[model samples]
Structures are given as C-alpha cells and as structure tokens.
Target: MPAASASSARSNSALSGSRCHDRLRTFHERLQSGWRMSAPLELFSYWRSSAAYRVRIGLNIKALAYVTHPVHLVRDGGEQHAAAYAQLNPQQLVPTLRHGAVVVPQSLAILEYLEEAFPDSARLLPAAPFERARVRALAQAIACDVHPLNNLRVMQLLEREWQRDAAQRLHWTQHWMQQGFAALELQLANALHTASFCHGDTPGLADCVLIPQLYNARRFEVDLAPYPTLQRIEQACLALPAFDAARPEMQIDAVV
Candidate 1:
C-alpha cells in the first residue's frame, strides 16, 4: 500500500476499535444501568451546511449508524420550506436527527443528545465539569458566534432583502468569520487545555464543531494564517476516520 493508504487503513482500524469499545461499554450500561442505547437513527441534512456537518462528525465519533436524508438547500427554491420537512423540523433546518420516535433539531443539541443517548461512546465532552465547560465554550465560540452570521437564510436575506450583490455577501461572510476566528485563535494560543485537539489530546465536542467552521471559513476566503494552533488541530482531526468520513464532500448528496 502507498503511504497515504497505509495511514488511512490505520485510521480506519482505530475508528473500528473505538466503535467496538463503545459497543461493549453500551452493553455494560444496558445491563448494569437502565439506559437504552440502541435505536434506529435518521439524520436530515444538507451536504454543504456546516451545522449539519458538526452533527455528522458527532454521530460518526459515537460510532452510531444513521440513515441520511439529503435536503438540497439550493434546489427547488429550498426544500426545507416544504410542509413535509417542516413537520419534522419546525425551523426547517438541515440537521434534524431522528432516533426512533424522538426527534432532535439543532446541531449542538444533537451533539449533546448523542453523548447522552450513547454514553459509552468515545466521550464528546470530558467527565470533569470544568474541562467540560471549557470544551463547550470553545465549541460555542465557533458554532454560535462564527456560524450564525453566515447562515444560508441570513445570506439570502442579505441578497434579496437588502439588495446586496455577491461581493457584498462574500465580504459579510469573511468579516464575521475573521472576527470569530481571531477570538478563538487567542483563546487556543493562551489556554492551558489546548492540546492535540481543542480540549485535550483526543478529539471531542469542540473539535466536532470547529472543524466544520474551518470548512466554512475556507469557503468564504477567511485568512487563517494567524491561527497556527487552530490549523494544527484541524489537520490532526482531518487525519482521523471519524472526521474524514463526515466531511461535506464525502456525503452521498454532494455535487461536483
């Protein structure tokens, strides 16, 4: 095998091992504890939506199997507005995870739900309360601060409602991404928790969120040269099977 192929095989093996461990832990929880860990899962998502991307990474990290319902955000005047999609997600968002009968909307909520629903999986958050709070804060800095201003609806409103052109929209996207990234860069540079990943050496919830935000940042041409720590962590994440498998381009509905 080529070097890249060998690396990929190793990553796949590690991912499989992680999933197997999670399964055993889940079984222990089921027998020793009262938590129901297994259920049919369905994720309604769009290929390019960064919010949806975060949930995908979380599910993959948990080693949970879920069906994908691709909602093409730009096709047919946006399918999310249709009554069928709205019934499942009142907000008509791209990432609504269905676990048997329980439906969950919002990417962060879905991440938290997966952690709670599959407690035995590779932990997305730390057990230490202070460490967990730090991770959550990092995740929110990107998901809440950076991503919200660049939503599809927000951009569309800027175009049609405010009569802005493509250049203006791009500027709007880049501006917010830079602003948020600057703060995140500072935190990561100075924080003691910063390691191979956002919170620690292993990939966790903050990583799940930050990687997607980086994808969007690149899309908008936000300069990332100043954030060496952030970029280093992202490279580490992209090497992992959990993160690579959940990339937007890897989705079934991804267009050329």
Candidate 2:
C-alpha cells in the first residue's frame, strides 16, 4: 500500500463510511446499538513490531476476532509509506486499528478504547482509577521509555547518521533493554501489586507491554540474567493462551 498524504489520511474515516455497503452500515448500527458479537476490527500491523504486538495481545485478551491486514514494514522500503496505509494512519505507524469508520493509531489509546468499548470481555486495565494509572505507568515504562529509544527508526538513524555497524546496533539495543529491565525488575520484585502477572494474578495491560519488550530483548540476544522478576513473570504469562497467541511468530503474517 502506498503511503497516503496527511490530507488523504484524514479522509480515511469518511472514505470508509462511503465504501461501506448498506448492509455493512446496518451491521455497524447493530453493533452500535449494543450487539455483543465481535465486529470486524481490521488491524494494520507488522508482525515483529512491539507496538503492534501490544495491540495484538490486547485483542487476544479481550477475545476479539479481527482480521490481520499485514503491513510489511521493511518491504519495498516500508509499505507503510504507501498512500493507502498512510491514509489509514497519517503518522505511518504500525498497529493502526480500524473499527467501522474509526481509525485509531496509538497502541495505548487503542487498548484503552477497546477495554472501554467492549467492557464485557476480559478487562485489560483495573477498574480503580489509581490502579489503572499504575498499570498505565508500568506499561509506559516499557512503551515510552525502553521502546521509543530502540525503535526501528532510531536504530536506522544510528546506522545512517552515526555509522553504526551491526555490533554497535546490538550494543545499543542491549544497553537500553538492560537499563530498563534493571529498574523494572527491582520495581516488580518489591511491589506488592505484582502477583503471577504485573498488576495482579490475572494478566493486565502492564504485562502485555512487558512481555513483548522482553521478547524483543531476547530477539537481540540481550542478556536476561539480570532481570529475574521479569523472567519469572514472563514465564507465567507465556503459560496463558492469550499471551501465547499474541507471540510474533504466531501472527498470521509472521515471517518464516
């Protein structure tokens, strides 16, 4: 898909509405009228992208059935650059969610929205405001701190502008992963909130973010020996079907 210009991207919602046949519109109205069945939540995602992985896990936890529209991030210098995808996401980020005419871009916002809009399904965040905030903080620790620093674009910049070799790139990745894990491990190890998962006995939003980031750590051969708490929690998470289903290698578009 060619990247859509910002103007075109903004029009995706309207365009989607126009493209919907009468039955589709009726179907959506039925959904809006509080029909409980899963709607066709079209997710534009790259299998290996951790931000995208977060949303995948959320969807699985909510038990929502959605079609995966794989957006190859590395192919042809990024299919996200294509006009079609850019139209769906003006920012050209992966893991954009399409619910009827609504196009949600940010992963965290998408997760929260799904939890709110589909409350009967397994809740991702806690009901208490403070607890929700804490879960969001823990999730942001990984999403905002560890992730953005080592994202593909940042790594690309290191190689392009700083002339970093593969070894340098791996070092860069591991440095950030270890730094974040060090803090997270201690935090989780001490916090009474930590049960088998990050938030409580049941897996929540924090665990969703942590597990994927840890997956990335292992992917780059980042040493996990320093983060025993993270490892223990991750092992518990992997035992669940939801987390296992959301693994990158299990995605429909996962590269073999």
Candidate 3:
C-alpha cells in the first residue's frame, strides 16, 4: 500500500477513537450532573399494583423526578402482556424502571438500585450490615411471603383453574395476610429497633414494603384489629408526604 493511503487510514481510525472518547466523557458529565443521557427515569407501572406502589414510595422518598408509563393491569386483558413491555421485562411485571439505556425490573431490586445510584439522596437502607439485613428480612416477610400469594395472577389462577368464588378468594387473601401480619406484628412489637417506623424513627425499605401490603389488607377488609403494631406503623408512614403521595389513589392512572 502507498504510504499516504496508510497514513490517511490511521488518521481516520484515530479520529473515530477520539470521537468515542468524547461521547463517553459527555455521558459521564451528564450523569455526574444528575441529568440522564437521553431521558429521565421512566417507570412502567399499574396504579393499583402493590409492587408498583412500593417503587413509587421509594422514588418519592428519594425525591427523584421520574415519568410514569401506566400499564393497565386489568384493562383489555392486561397491557403488561404486550410485546413491547415484555421486551423491557420478560416477567411482564409492572414497576419496570428505565433509566437512560438501563432497564431494571422487580420492586426491591429497583429500590436497592436507587439507594446505590443516588447515595447522596435519602437512604432506604441502614448503614450497618445487621440493620440492613434486619430491614430486608422485614421487607421480604411482606413482599415475598405474603404479597405473592395474593397477587393478581394467583387470584386469576384460583378463579380460572380451581373455580374459587369471590367469597373464597377474599378468604384466601385475608388468611395469608393474617398469618404474615401476625408474625410481623410480633417481630415489630418486640424488636428493640422498632421506633416510630419499622426499623427506626424514619421510614425505610421495610416501611415501603409494609404499607402496600397494608393497603391490600384494607381493600380486602382484613381484620386489622389483631395487628395493633402494624396499624400504628401504617399511620406513622401515611403521615409522611412521601408515603401519602405514593398511594394508589394519588397516581394519575388511578381509576375512580
């Protein structure tokens, strides 16, 4: 090859590399400035969904600005079953968070991500390892053990497959909630860490998880008289603007 031709090829390659570096530097600068690359945070949510409600609380507590893309869970046989949303979250779940090019699914995972990504903002988990674990355990007691059993899919399955009536379904929800809340009431009522909120005076991850379940309990007319501790905590959490603003009724997509 001619020397000039080789020299021109090398120059073009160097130019391309330099452009890539510049683009990366710009992206980093935007992130550092708290500005997203192409867009701010976007949440694919269903207003009445407990999982989505949890994410909304976390985002509000952090005071992060985000846009909501409402995915109706019950309309037209559920919008989450669509191909577009499925690409974002193969689980076809609500509360799928999108930040720039990154996509995150699952409410707890999204909460943890927010805590890590925006460390300077309000914290969702405690600094101590043991405290974090304790909080997570409490959060999971509701999120994992209790909520899943009463999820929309579970109710649909019970109705479609097992021919469970509305009264039976109500019993199903109330029974699991009672069992879980009984254990949580004991744990929170006796734990030294319990204060105004689940872990301490300020609401954290567990509070976020707990409040949504409590909302469901009320919706199903679960006997709250048995769990005084939970009722107290729910009151404390609801008094806060973050928790209040994140309620299912406050959401734009909420149906009357």
TM agreement with the true structure for every prediction: 0.86, 0.86, 0.87
RMSD of each: 15.3, 12.9, 6.7
Question: How accurate locally is residue 173 in candidate 2, as Cα lDDT from 0 to 100?
Answer: 93
Each model's lDDT comes to: 0.91, 0.89, 0.93
lDDT by residue for model 1 over 2-116, one digit each (tens)?
A: 9999999999999999999999999896764442445678999999999999999998888988899999888999889899999999998889998877899999999998898
lDDT of 3 by residue, 1-256 (tens): 8999999999999999999999999999767656442468999999999999999999999998899999999889999999998998999988899988789999999999889878888999999999999999999999999999999999999999999999999999999999999999999996899999999988999999999999999999998998999999999999999999999999999996
**Predicted structure 2: lDDT:** 0.89
Better of 1 and 3 by lDDT: 3
lDDT of 2 by residue, 60-153 (tens): 9999999899999889999999999888899998989998777899899899888877878999988889888889999999999999999999
Top TM-score model: 3
